[model samples]
Structure formats: structure tokens, C-alpha cells
Target chain A: MIWLPLVGLAIGFQIYWLPGLSLPSSVAAYLSLATLAGLDSIFGGIRAGIEGKFHDDIFFSGFVVNTLLAAALAYLGDQIGVDLFLAAVVALGGRIFLNLSLIRRYLLTETRLRWRREG
Target chain B: MSTIASPPSRGKGWVFQVTALCIVLGMLLALSLRTQRRAVSEGIPNRWPALRAEFINLKQQNASLQKDLAEYKERYEELLRKQATGQAATLGLESVLQEAKMLAGQIAVHGPGIIVTLHDSPKRDVNETRPEVIENYIVHDYDIRAVVNELFAAGAEAISVNGQRLIATSSIRCVGPVILVNSVQVAAPYVIKAIGKPDVLQKALELPGGAADGLFLLDMIEVKQQPDITVPAYSGSMRFYWAKPLPQPKEKSR
Candidate 1:
């Protein structure tokens, strides 16, 4: 968990601080969908961690597979002249919202239980 | 969070891997955003007004710079005349100056050469038949490059299209309906002026299987040779940041 925030910062610096380094416009759609999928996985992982159900294998594999599948779907769509990345975006976005709601509920219950014990 | 039954050491490893994956995700997000921003900013829709303003600014700067260069060149020539002792040295200096002027497009060139004019065909009505052929009616960037290439191969010393002098770095492109030469927008009828031996330039363009012949077969084009023609000096910057002259090998003393 500690390494997570540090790694995030390093990646941020690598992107925003580097000059004359840019991805091609054609690949933006694919990268965007992959990013969305990655976001969903990270949130899901956090929720699972908080609930004491986080599995090392599942979390790591899910992260890699989700991103790769999203990007692959986008590329396939490009080759076929269809907007398939939008499908990936919708699926990942729905999952992210669902994960957020669960996270919220767990936090609320945990806080209530702790307060009751203190009282 | 730590209350799970899994071993603490194994849990830490998972956390590290997941975190590393998150970092990769973050980098991808940043790159996607930057690429999108660049695409928008560099796209034709957003750059038109900005480029127009920049073109005007550069034109003004070019004029002022040319004036300053002429003044300095005159001063330098005067100094050279006063310092030189021999006629041979003076003649050599004059020849070098002429060579430099030609290469830099600094001096207005006048010689017997050819003038080639290209005109885009008049647009047709909405219901015209053979609609696919309409694309062939208009002049393209490649057509201009072809003609320019032929003129240079025919030994044209200087050339200009619609008053924009052609230089090594000059780019001719088509943006929508108009042609852009050295970043200046020009519309048809396009007039190309080349300074060389009149007969040779004319013959090169009139070659049976040449760029000019191809244009004539497809569209309306006019080629004329004159006794004298003038091509204006190049008005753009010639500064090169990346290209460098190769170092010469030192010769062993005999």
C-alpha cells in the first residue's frame, strides 16, 4: 500500500515532467479505455482490501488482464471500423461506480461499529 | 484490512504488485490526456487563426531583417574595396559574393526562363454526372512539386510560385481549397516563374512524357518562355538547427 502511492507519484512525474514525449493521436482511444479499466481494478482492489478479502493473485492478474483486454477491444474495433472502445468504457465505468458504492457502505458500517464500541 | 487470514508477508507482495500496476495505469492516463490535448491544439480547426497571425508576424519580421541585411552587405563591400590591394583578390571576392547571393536567394534573379500557369477548373453544379472526375479538375500539391522538380532538373537557377520564392526548406501543400506555399495561402490561377536558359527550361517542360504534359492532359495549363524574367529573393529564414556540414579530412603534407 505504501509503495502504491509512491509508484503513482513517480509515474505522474515521468509523464507530466518529460518534455517532447508524446503518444500518437491514433492510440489515444486505446490508452484511454485501458486507463478506465485500470481505474476500475484499482478501486475494486481497494474495496476488497478494506473488507479483508483481497487476494494477491486475483488483484494482480485482474489489473493486467483488464487493461490488456480493454486495449485489445479498442484495436479490434479500429480494424473493423466500429467504435468498440465505447463498450469497454461503459463496462469498466459501470464497475467503477458499483465498487465505489460498496466502498462507501463498508466505510460507513466500519465507522458506526467503532463509534458504538467507543461509547 | 490486516485481519484477513492470509500470511502478512504474502499480502505485502500482492500489495506491491497491485501498486506497481496502478502506477502503470496512471502513466497511461497522463499520456492519453496529453495526446488528446495535442491532437486538438494541432488540428486544422484550431490552428487556422493562430497560423494566420503567425504568418503575418513572420512576414513583417522578414521584411525588416532583409532591410538590415542589405545595409550591412553594402557596408561590408565598401570595407572590402578599401582594404583589398590586388585586382585578382577583388575579382575573386566579387565572384564569391555572386555565388553566395544565388545560393541564399538574396539577390533578385533575372534571366531568360519559362513561366508555367496552372488553373483549377470551374466547379460544376450539384447534379453533374461523373462526379468522381471532379477531383481531377483541381490542382494538387503533388502537381506543383512535380513541376518544380522538372524545372530544377532542367537547370533553373531560381524559381518562385505566385511571388513566394522556392527554397530548400519551402513546403508546398494543399489545405482544403487553397494551396499553401511557404505557409502563405495562394489560390488559382497559380503562376510558376523559373529563371534559367529560356530554351532549355521550355524544352524540359514540353517533354512528351513529363509533369507539364500530364497536367495539360488532365487540366488547363499554360507554358511560355520569355527573353527575360525575374525571380524574387526568398523571404523566409534559412537557419538550420539540425543539419551540419561534414568535417573535411586533413591532408598529409607532401
Candidate 2:
């Protein structure tokens, strides 16, 4: 899961060659928000997996719903003259940070225990 | 913590799904950032009917917000009038805010000033068969920027080009054949309106070797001083993501 973004980065290089695949500038906001939502779902799934609660169905549905909801919120904001995407951004951003912190703590504690037992 | 139960190994298929989704998400994020950068450097193309709809919606929302703001201000003023000390303090703060808004180009300004209109010379192609010298006959982004810089130097309080108000972050650049002011494409003839002293602005422009004279010599730019004009406030996001105020130092406890 940690290496997932790096893999995405490697694949992102193809975007330069496939210029026609690029989205219109107008939808950039929605797309970016959707990506944020997707990233949040991914991290949540990873956390769930680590906590012995990973479920395939939950991960799949959560990913799709989160993305769509985020995009929809941005579209609604554009229509209503408010930046609803900011809410999604802040929420998803906070979750990502929280999840990362937990993941870091878990990994650190696991490594320390394993090291003590081995020694 | 180390002895905690881990989830059952998800099959390769689940791994594949998550990996694929992650890749897609990464690509989308990268593409969005790239598009944002392009839009910043070379103004986004004014395409899509949806954008026009969004513009209409935004205009209506702006009107409603303005109404709400006025109502809120009136309520606040009424409350302030009830407290003499708070009223004075608030009055001072209000004036400071107004001045700050003016300086930030966030407030609409109206005053006597000059209007400089720059257009490509009509007789350029008619007389000169040489295509290389045609560049001198047309207005460029730098020309507009120079004119703006000169106007500011003359103490112009506010300025707008093609109704796009100039702010601190306003960028003027040439994209292809069109000139972009504040990332909005502006077509010729570019009518630049500046709010300041009418005579001083006019004089500053017409000064020898100034923006007006240099442009006129090259492209026959027109500078006009009008007695009354209005420059609208900036209508864009003022968010500064990278900058933050430093935390105040706390007094050391004895």
C-alpha cells in the first residue's frame, strides 16, 4: 500500500504520450477532489486491513462512492457559488494525515517489539 | 501491539483491484496538477458551455452575496451604535479594513482617471509588405504591462483592462495571438481604465519616452483622460496556501 502511489507515479508518465487522454481544464477541480477521496478510501482500506477488518466489498464500494460524492460536491459548489470541494479536501486531507500517523505508529511499535524478541 | 491479529490474506485479485485503483487515482492527481500549472502559465481556454453556465450562476450568487453582506453590515452598524466605546474602536477597524481592501484591490473604486486604448495599427499591413516588421504594429502583453506599470507609478489607485481588475497577483501574458489579463483572454482594442487624478495620469502617460509615447510610436496607441470612471474589485480567490503567519512568542514563565 505504501508503494502504491509510487507505482501510480511510474504509470503517470504515459500521460505525456497520450495527450488526448487528458481531461478538460474545467473538470480539474472535480477530478482532483475525486482523487483525494479515492486516496482516502485507499488509506482507510489499508488501515482496515492492518486492523484485521479488511473486506473486499467494503473497499470497492467505499472507493466508488467516495469519488462520486466528492465530484458531486464540487459540482454542487460550482452551481451554488460556494466551494463545497473545500469541505471534501479538508476532510479527506485530515483523514489521510490521521491514517498515516496511525500506520506509522503501528509500524514503529511492531518493529520495536520484533527487535526486542529477536534480541 | 506486535501480537495483534492481522486480516486474512486477501487474494491476488483484491490486491490487483486496490493497486489498479491507486494507479488511476495517482494519474488523475498528476493530470489535475499539470492542467492547473498550464492554466496558470497560459490561461485556460475559454471553452465549454458548462463554464458559461457556471459564470451565470456565479454572477447571480455574487449579487445575492452582496445583498447579504449589506444586510450584515447594517446589522453590525446598528449594534455598534449602541456601544460608544466599541463603536469608536469598530469605526477605526472598519476604516482600516476599507483601506486594506482598497490596497489589496479587493474593493471597487470610482474616480476621475485616464483610459488608454491600445490597438493594432490599421495601416501596418497596407504599407509594409515585410512581415517581420508587423510585430511593431500590434500590441503585446509586455506593452500592456508597461502601460500598467507606468500608470501605477503615477499613483493610480485602481486599474482594469477589459473589465478584469488588476490585483497584486494579476498576471499579463501573451498566449498565441491574444493577450491574457488575470488569466482571462482579452481581445483588442484593449481599453485600460485607471482610477486616479485625471490630469496626473494623463500627463504621466504622455511624458516623453513613456509607455504612451513608446507605444504610440510603435503601434499608435490612444490615451484618453476621462473625468469619471469606475474600476471593479477583484473577483478571484485570494487564498495563499504557501504562506502562513508566524506564531507569536509566549512570555517565559519565571
Clashes in model 1: which pairs? none
| lDDT by residue (tens digit), candidate 1, B1-254 | 45344433334454565576667766767776787677666652221233445776898999999999999999999888877756767888899899988887877888899899988755434565685777677788888888999999999989999999988788899888788999999878889999888889888888999877867776557889988989999887778799999998885941
Off by over 4 Å in 2: A1-119, B1-82, B127-129, B247-254
In candidate 2, residue B10 scores what lDDT?
A: 51
What TM value does model 1 have?
0.42
Best DockQ goes to which candidate?
A: 1
Worst 10 residues of 2 chain B by lDDT: B1-10
Show the lowest summed lDDT stretch of 10 residues, model 2 chain A: A13-22
Residue A99 in candidate 1, Cα distance off native in Å? 99
lDDT of 2: 0.79
Kept native contacts, as fractions per model, are: 0.37, 0.26
Indicate the residue-level lDDT of A20 in model 2. 35
lDDT of all the models against the reference? 0.78, 0.79
Say what the RMSD of model 1 is.
Answer: 37.4
